[model samples]
Every structure is written in C-alpha cells, then in structure tokens.
Target chain A: MTHVITDACVDEKDASCMEECPVDCIYEGGSRMYIHPGECIDCGLCAEVCPNGAAVALRLLDPAAAAVHGPANDAFFTRVLPGRQAPLGSPGGASRLGPLDVDPS
Target chain B: MTTHHPAPHHPAAHHAAAHHPRAHHPAVVDAEACSAALDRGETLPWTWYADPAITALEQERIFRRSWSYVGRTDQVAQPGQFFTCEVGGVPIVVTRDRSGGLNALVNVCRHRGAQVVREDCGTRKSLQCFYHAWTYGLDGSLRGVPRGDREADFDTSQLGLRRASVDTWGPFVFVHLDPEPAPLTEMLGELPELLAAGGIDLERMRFHHRVYYTIEANWKIAVENYLECYHCPVAHPGLADVLDVSPDAYELEVRPTFATHHGVVRDIPREAGYPVQGPVVEGQYHLVWPSLKVNVNPGQPNLSFGPVHPAGPERTTGYLDYFFGDDVDEAWIKAMLAFDDQVGAEDTDLVESVQRGASSGGVERGRLLLGSEHTISAFQRFVLGRLRED
Candidate 1:
C-alpha cells in the first residue's frame, strides 16, 4: 500500500523526508509533504525520516488515521489542492516542481 | 561445483564470432578495406571524453542504472563483516547481519543525509552515524537515535537504512542502485562459463591483494581501451607477447550483456616480470556491459576483477582485487601482479595521451577498422545508445 501523510504533518513540514526519498515521490505542499500514491514505491524512507512521524503507510495507520489521511493524500494530487488549478499528478521528483503553497484542507 | 568452463572460445575464424550487426564481420575482412577504415577511424569525437556534461549523463544513465561489481563474497564471509563502496558515485555499505543475511544499504543516514558507515571495511554490532549518534543494526533496522527519541513520534522501525540491490556470481559481489534489481545472472550472460573455460575456479580463489589505478581519461575511454587489443602490439609489448594480440588470431565473442576475448598465451620463458605458463592456457578478458572487467591470466588458478568508475568526465578510477588459489606459491603471485602492473602502467600512459588529444579539439572522430576493433565499435554503440535514451 502507499504511504499516507496525516494531519500530524499540518505545519511540521520538517522536509527531512524529501531528502531521503529514493524515488522522490514526496512533494511539499504549502502545509505538508504529499506522497504520490502512484509514484510511491512504499520504500518508507519518508516515514522513517519524518521526525514528526507524519508520513505513515496506509496499512500501518490506525483505522481512523487511514480513513482520513489516506484519502487526503490521494486528494492532494488527484483532486488538486488550494492555490492550484490542476491535479499535481506524479511530477516525477519534488526537486523538479519545488515546494508549493498548496495542501489538502 | 566445477566452474563449468569447458572450452574458452578460441575462434579459428574471428569472423565466426562476429554477430553484432554493423560489427567488423565481413566473412572475409578485406585487407585494403581494413586499411582504409583504419585511415578513416570510426572513433567518437574527443568531446565525449573531455566534456563534463557528457560525463554527467553517463553517471545517470549508465552507472546509476546498471549493476557493477563492487567486492568479493569472501569480504563478508562471516556474520558482522561489512565493506563500504560506491556504485555510480553513491555511497554503499554491504553488510552481513547477525542472521547471516547480506544487505546493501545506502550508507547515508535516515537523518540529515550524512554517511553512516565511514570506514572502508569493518565488522560491527551496529552502525552509528558520527553526526548525531543514530545507530542502525546490521540488518539496517534503526536501533538508537541519540537523546532525541523523547519526541512523541520517533519510530525506529520506519527509519532504518535505505537499501539497494546486491547479488553474487561465484565470489564476485555486484550492487545496483535499484532497490530490487534484475538478477545478476541476467547481466552476466556466459561470463562465468567463459571465465571457467579460461581455466579459473572461483571456488578455489582466495583474497590475495588489490591494485587501484587512477587514469586521466573518461571511464568510457578506459572501457573502450579494454574492449580491443589493436594497440596492444605498439603500446603493450609485454602484453602482446603474453596475450596473442595478433589481429587475425585474437578472438572476440559478443553476448547480449557481455563480451569475451580469448588471448592465447605465447609459449616462452615465464619471467618474474612476466606471467608463468600453467593452470590457465588462455587469458580470458571479459567485460560485463557497463563497466566490469574480469581478467583470468595464465598461471596458477587466479582471477582479478573490478569496475572502471568515473571519477569525473576527465578522469577514471578503479581497483583490481586479485584472487588466487591458496595453494599457489607466493613468488608466482608476485610475478603475475608485477606483470599486470607493467601492462596497466603502459595503458595509463596511452589513455592519458588519448584524453589529451580528445580535449585538444583538433580531431572530430575516427573511422573504425572494424575487422580488428569491432569490439570497440560495439561498446561505443552501447554507450551512444544509452546516452541517447533520454
């Protein structure tokens, strides 16, 4: 399963996760780092490097955490977030698109 | 197991060994045509060797994506043993956990990206990064993290070291950046069998010594030099005598992932500054795709293999880890090492000169005398195709 970023990450965007991700699947939104559901290799480096433990796999999350963050994680890319006109499908690497002032509500 | 190398391909017709299309296999290589092509020279422009941008593309497309030899299996024979190396310039640490399992970790910490294992080789209970004291077990599971664990959400399991792909062929250990790369066998083709046919037993090989070489040329230039022996007569007189570097007799076999050359050793005195005649009758020089070189010299059972790594666009560096049968005499090993060194030294001079010419901007490209240098043409094509993949 893909990794889901929860509310625990709201403003605690340590961004340490961005540095360790092998596939560069984690992108920075205005408020949090979003893991691309399609691009995430389930490598778990993002979750491991997250000092706030904001990055968690969908399977490992609590039922409540998964129900909310898992869908929100997908929505962050698939349904476009604030300050964005289009969905941010897999842009390959976070470095390419850089940090965005956008995130799921 | 018997190293299953029954017959090293000493092709009576070097032409029969020509399979790659556009290769120098013209059934009957016209001597006049060969002369004309040599005059024209099918070599790439010097920029490929002198340009930093070309080197960057190679690091990304070739080295980072392909599997190359990093070390020998014996380096991690016992549990807790480990060796650190680089694959395409990325730091890697290969470890054997307490459970006897092997792991190829990123070597970079899950923390701020500092390399965790700094030593070249060692055996330890766990890895502790010097920066902030983040410790990881031999299996790559994070074990400890300084005094900062008081944070409510510091989960050690999720923060273990990142892993790459590791596999072995006989005693040769290969690593790839991809977490789970294709099986090493897929990339090895008939190499192991061919090396065996050249009279080497990886099972009997033991760690002897290693010799590192730094050359002032692109890694591709170093590799291209290895693919053919057309210059062996002029540049490597000693090697020419030892490896039957005749254009007509030198054997070249190209597989999908590797290429093999059969060098029939000339019958002569086994000088201390030269190789002895025994165990190995033919010298099998094999290259595995991107950058691995497997050399089986004629002498007591021996094998020395390693990767040609790109230090930069204008420089290449690599090491040959020598292995010989434990029963072989020490003096014989020394002589073989010396002979190999002499040839390597000569090669260093040639490649450096070639690099100078490439960087000089006086030449455009050289046409190939495909008859004797088809192997190089194939390799150059491989490099060109890879760089153009994007």
Candidate 2:
C-alpha cells in the first residue's frame, strides 16, 4: 500500500511530506504535492512530514475507503497530474474533451 | 534529422490571414511585430483556440522548439528522483543525476515504447523499464539491458535515453525537445521585469502550495480569464474587496511584447464573513502574457499562478505558487491559504460557467462591455489579432 495526498492538500499545500520522504517519492503540484504510488516505498515518510495533515497511507486490509482509492487516484491523476487548461469540476467529470473553441453542451 | 525549409506562404500564415481581412500573415512573427500589434490596439485573432491546424504547427515551432517550464527544481531532489511530464503532448522525464544536476529525457524507452518513469514522481537509483528491465541512469545514460548480448551487434551508447534541451529559470525547470532551441530568457521577452515587481525572488522562495485543476474550458479561456480582472467585482467578491475597483485603478499596461493590469479594491466587509485579514494590497493584478500571473496582497506573500498548460486548448492545467517574505509567520501563511482557496473557488465557478456557456448557440463573438472590463477586451483583441496573423 502507498501513501496518497488527497484534495485536503489543495489548500494546505504543506510540503512537509516532501521533505520527510526518504526516497523523495513526493512531487509538487500547482496547489498540492503528491506521492507517486508507483515509486512510494510505502515507508510512510510522507505521513510524518505533512504539515496540514493531508496525507493518507493506504492499507488494503483497512476495508473502510479502499473502494474509493481507484476513483480518487483517477481524480488526482487526471486533475492534479496532467492538469487541463480548463477546470476539473466544470462538468463534474466530463471524460470527453472537445475542440478548444467548440463549446461542448 | 530532417531539415524542412520555411516554405513560401507557410500553412500557418494562410490560416492566420483567414480570420481577419488581411491578405497575408506570417507563420512566425518576431517580437517587434507582435509588440506593434499591441501598440495599434488591433484585436488579435482567436485562432490560438479555434485552429487545431495552427496548434499543431505551434507544437513544433513553439513548444517543441522553445524552453518550456516542465516542473520545479525541487521535483528531482536527489539522484534518480524523477517525474514524468508532457511537452507538446510528448511525455518526457525530469531526473536528478548522481552529480545532483537535473536532466530531461523522453520517457519512452529505446527497446520498448514503455514509459521510463511509470510514476508521476519518485526517487530511484536508476530508471528501469517495467516491461523488460532495460535501465537508464539518472543522467539519462543507458545503464543496462537484461540479455541483449544474443543480438551480436548491440551498441548501448546508441540506446541511451533521448535527451531534451533542459534549462532552469528561477525555480522553474524547462525542457525543449528541439536540439537547438532559443534560450529561455530570450523567449520570455519582458516577463522577468513584470515578475520582479511581484517580488519574485526565486532563491528566497520555497515550494509551499501546489494544486492542479483540470478545466473543461479551452486553455485559452482560462488564460483570458486570468489576463483580465473585470470579473473581480462581480465574480470574485472576496478579491474585489481587497483591491480598489475602478477603471483608473485597473488599467491595462501594454508594451510591444507584454501586457498587465494592476489595481486595488477596498477590503471586503468583515460583516460579510469572507476569508480576508490584515492590510491586503489594494487590487494589484499583474498579467504576464502567454501564461503567468503574479498576484500581490500587501501583507500577504506574493502569489504566482503560472498556468503550465498554456496552449492545452481543450483542457488546461495551472500551477499556483504562493511566496512569503521571511516576515510572514506560519499562522499568516495558513490564513493566506484560506483566502486563496476562497478566491480560487470563485474563479473556478466563473471559468467553469464560461466553458459551459461558450458551447451554447449564439456566442460566435460575445459583445464586450468596455470600461468596466477593459482587460478582457484587451486580452480578446490581443488573442484575436495574434490568431488572425500567421
């Protein structure tokens, strides 16, 4: 299991997680930094460094919110990773990206 | 390497002229010509958003060939610390070498098309292809091949990861796919001076906040929204309260190659229960053309919103950086973040609405209400004129 930064990090942007990561798995974004699940050794350095307390270390055994991880990762990757010139929450979650000037209904 | 000459009447030129009543438009105009357009007050064409053909052309001429901001110097903090990003939609990797120097390479591996850096970011002693264990050094040198000796004639040097032209300006790390790209400073024209006014001391500043929003609006719309502050009074009540609102307070400062608007609005009524504190800079908004913003709030740290996906037409990603002078304490920083989030929410609402409305019928070119929102008019003219020309 890996540690993930959630939307809570958006306003927090506390980079303590970045400094604590021994492997430096955390990467900064526009408003928040993220821990790369692939590279995160799951050693939990991020959880220690986070200032606003926005990082979450995922454990598969903890069946509470495991189901939401996939969607959350998708949201973080698509919205936080690549970043659109547009706004992520506009249509809530419009997968289709029309032509720039084309006003999608 | 295929060298293609700039043919007579480049395709971009024809497309630029088609948008306006002009007979001809050059594919690539110099900084001076662009400045002249700004001087004459001629509205630039809107092809930066509408023309996919022109966008494709820019991918090669602008993004591929120019030094573009890829990430922060802090991204690759140590050897093998690497991250994947896209330049002109081409995925590339930014890594730290054993020598601690940063390098950018195409994420695609030589043996297989698999991405060298599967994760968005991480620290590794070496980048190994997940598909076949083909490895690369932190400095982008080819390091290993699982069992390629059977090939009989395998030159490892030739298989080194593809290198890109990478440079650093301030905290921003930029990469250029073109082997011989123009220097980053030259491409920035007069942007540095504008950023300086916002107290952009790169060394003094450290990474504080990062949030990415994937908007449905064309990247241009987001840029346009950012370039102007006309919507501040109505759309951003929280922000408008801090800056003095008036035509004189928020006038467009346009040079040949740049344009910016700064103003101040009275603080929002505390009774209104908005997130604001201390003496805020009275409506000082600086717009560094193309895609950058340096926002100042007197007592608060200067906030720079550099939209990385400047030309991502269909979608846009923006980088928001908040820089605090040493005088700022942790509590102040937390309060500032609260204020920032509130203002960001307002912007998100307006921009998302505009993205949705642009698609509705009867918006070919929305009428501009001058005086109050002249920044938008200025931005629209610049964009339309730039697009209209080749």
Candidate 3:
C-alpha cells in the first residue's frame, strides 16, 4: 500500500517527510503538502519522521477516507486546478507551479 | 496578514505619563536625558526595555550596522564546510571556499526565497534549493538552473546569491549586513590585545559545544544583565563563589567599540571541581555592541561567545559556544559546562522577572548605582548613540 498525507499536515507543511522520503515523492502544495502516489516507494520512512503524525500508510486509514485521499492526491498532480492545463508531474518542485490554493484532504 | 493598530490612548502611554515623570512617552527615549544620564551614570528610562517600536528601531539602526558574531572559525575550517546563522533576522550561510577564503551569502534562493542551506552545519560542494533544483557553487555563484534551456531570457550571472561582508578574528567568525562595513579589526579596537594581555591563547582553543536558551525578555535586557555584575551578590550566588563579587575586586573598562569587565577570582575552594589548580585567576568578560559576548572564566583555558537575536518585542533567543584548549579533559569540560549552565539559569530567572517589571508600567526607570554599574550605563549610551544616528 502507498503512503498518504493526512489532515494533520494542513498549514503545518513541515518538510521533514519530504526530506525523509527516499524517492523525493513528497510534493508541497498551497495549504498542505502532497506525496506523489506513483512515485512513492511505500518505504514508510515519512511516517516515522513526521512530527505532526500527518504521514500515514494508506492501509492504516479508514476505507472511506482513503478512497477520497487517494483520488485527491492523484488529482493534485493529474488535474490542472488554477493556472496550468496539465498535471504537474515531477516538475522538480511543487513551488514552481506555485501554491494550488486548494485544501488537501 | 492582520494589522494591529494600538489604541489611541494605550494603557502603556497613560502609565508612562502618570508613574514615570521622566518618561519619554510615545518615543520612550529622551535625547537630552539619555545624553545627560551617561555623564550622571544612570540607566535609561524603563520604557526602552518594553516598547515594540523601540525594538524595531534597534533592529534597523543597531543590529544591521554592527559586525555581529556568527560562529567560531574552526566551525567552517575546511573548504566546502559551511554553517547557517542569522543577523538581524536575515538568514546567512558562511562557507569556506576552495581557495580557503571565507564567504557569507544570504541563504535565500533567487527563485522562490526558499532557504538553500537548511542544515545548521554541513559540508557540501554546492547548495541547492529543495523547493526547486536551482543550485549554487560553494562560492555562492548560481551554478545551475534545472531547466535553463527552456528559459531563454534568464540571466544567471545577475542572479548569484547575495553576499554579506565576513571576517574572522582568532577563533571567531563575524558577518555584517552592510556591504561596506568598517574593517572588523577596527571595530574590535584593542579587544584582541586585551584578550592577549589577559593570558588568553587564541591559537590553542577549539569549539566544544553550544547551549541555547530562549528568554522571555527584550534582547537589551539580557545584554544589560550581562554588562554589569551588580546583581551577582543577590542573583548569582553560584557565580559569585568562583568570581570575586566585591566592588573593589571588579574593574570595568568602557571603550569606544566595546566594554569589558576584569574580575579577580576569590580563592578557589579546593572542594570546587576546577580542572586547573592554580593561585587566584582573573575572569574576563567582554561585550561588543549590539549583541555579542565573550567570556573567559578564571583558572582554565575556556572561552564562550555568542549572539542574542531578538525574536520579538519581549522575547530573545541566545546561544553560547563553549571552547577549550586541547589540554583540557572531557570530564573537566563537562563540569565547567554544568557550572556555566547553573549560573545561566540564575541569570535567566532574574532577567525574565525584570522583563515583567519593565512591562508592568509601575516602574519608570532604573538608576545605575555608580562604580559597579558603569558598564550598564555605557551600554545604554552606546544604544542611544546608534539610535540617534538615524
């Protein structure tokens, strides 16, 4: 199962998870940070170092909430929210597209 | 961002007018009395200690203009070694270049203001922003842009990391925000000679450890507390036991660029765990204006120096770097550090209480009792001198 960023990270976009993620899949967002689902190695390193308990394995979440976060995380990269037309992919950093200004689940 | 406007008739203003007859209300600094008090040897009005406006003024006029101490030279001794610190809220990284030259560069990335060097200390061939892959050479030249080919008009030469003036004296490293600051040697003015005269060997010292404390007091209050030993007998009994607390045993020298206190230690209690056994020794304390303190304890080859940065109007964060010679044993170093921690705890409690008193609005100002507290008065004068320059 892949890892997901929970509600605990909103407004507290602490980058410890980004630093700990071996694949560098954790991407920053407008309000909260996002972890690229396709790129995540499911190593669980992010969950261990998160001071706010924001990072969690998808299997650990309630089935209903996981269903929402799974799509929302995918949509962050795959859907153009405000300024752009296509998914962000791995444009090196989330900051390049600037903040999406959308709340992350 | 929410903006807070003070009430037209703030309670602090009313209190200042009623209780403090000498209060320079609103501005809180009476130019005439501040100047006269220097000669009279009295402390500045207490309002200076608690005013947010005054703290802002000090940030621009004092901290920015002074050569603030950043860290020890040995901290970034090797090429590519670097450490990040701040002066007046501006983040800076000090690195030793390939040619053995020390360079201080603003830590912000040109692309999105992200800090390029996140760690406190590390060795790196280049600094790269984590937000994007924009990279800079260790010498602070913008080396690479992740997608440079796509940006046809982007000029990399003009976007190199901003540099600040950096210098080193003995084991200390200092940085100045002003591009053209007076030579660090000139600013130090006889401090090196004075330390040498006091038997401090700059060559033998090596950095040991750093302890930080966040005090709920204005940065000036912490500094004033350090400038004078007047409260030693009452507040720091532990410190008084090692260093002579008597008025006659202490001598304060107020220089143009710095202030110093030389105190002869009382007889070392054989029971006291002093690593070096010797006759009575002298403790040297020096303060370079704005926010750097250097302390050399008696009976050992030890040095502690650091800066106090203002976190807010009534808050300060300070760190002290402890250094000792190669000859000192680890057990003795630990004992010395413990002793210092005990003394620091005592001072912290005292300064925090003084912050409360200054903010209470009942007390107008403090009087600097002559002879013992001249250094404190001198410090006030220096602060006023800098503030008035603008």
Candidate 2 regions with alpha-carbon error over 4 angstroms? A1-105, B1-62, B255-258, B265-289, B308-313, B367-390
Model 1, range B15-37, lDDT digits (tens) per residue? Answer: 21122222221211233443343
Question: TM-score for each prediction?
Answer: 0.69, 0.62, 0.72
Residue pairs in candidate 1 whose N, alpha carbon or C atoms collide under 3 angstroms: A30-A102, B5-B197, B40-B367, B41-B366, B41-B367, B41-B368, B42-B366, B42-B367, B42-B368, B43-B366
**All candidates in order of lDDT, best leading:** 3, 1, 2
Candidate 3 per-residue lDDT, tens place, B62-162, comes to 88888999988888999889999988778999999878889999999999999989999988666777776666777888855644544688898988899
Q: Which candidate achieves the best DockQ against the true structure?
A: 3
**Model 1 chain B weakest 10-residue run by lDDT:** B1-10
Better of 2 and 3 by lDDT: 3
Candidate 3 lDDT, A1-105, residue by residue in tens: 677887688889887877655557888777777887777656455775577988877776899989977777666777775666666776654444444566423
Candidate 3 segments exceeding 4 Å error: A1-105, B1-29, B146-153, B267-276
- lDDT per residue for candidate 1 within A2-86, as digits (tens), equals 7778778888888777776666788888888888888876655566556687888787677887888888878877886677788
Per-model CA lDDT versus the true structure? 0.74, 0.57, 0.75
Instruction: For all candidates, state DockQ relative to the true structure.
Output: 0.02, 0.02, 0.03
Distance (Å) between predicted and true CA of B48, model 2? Answer: 7.1
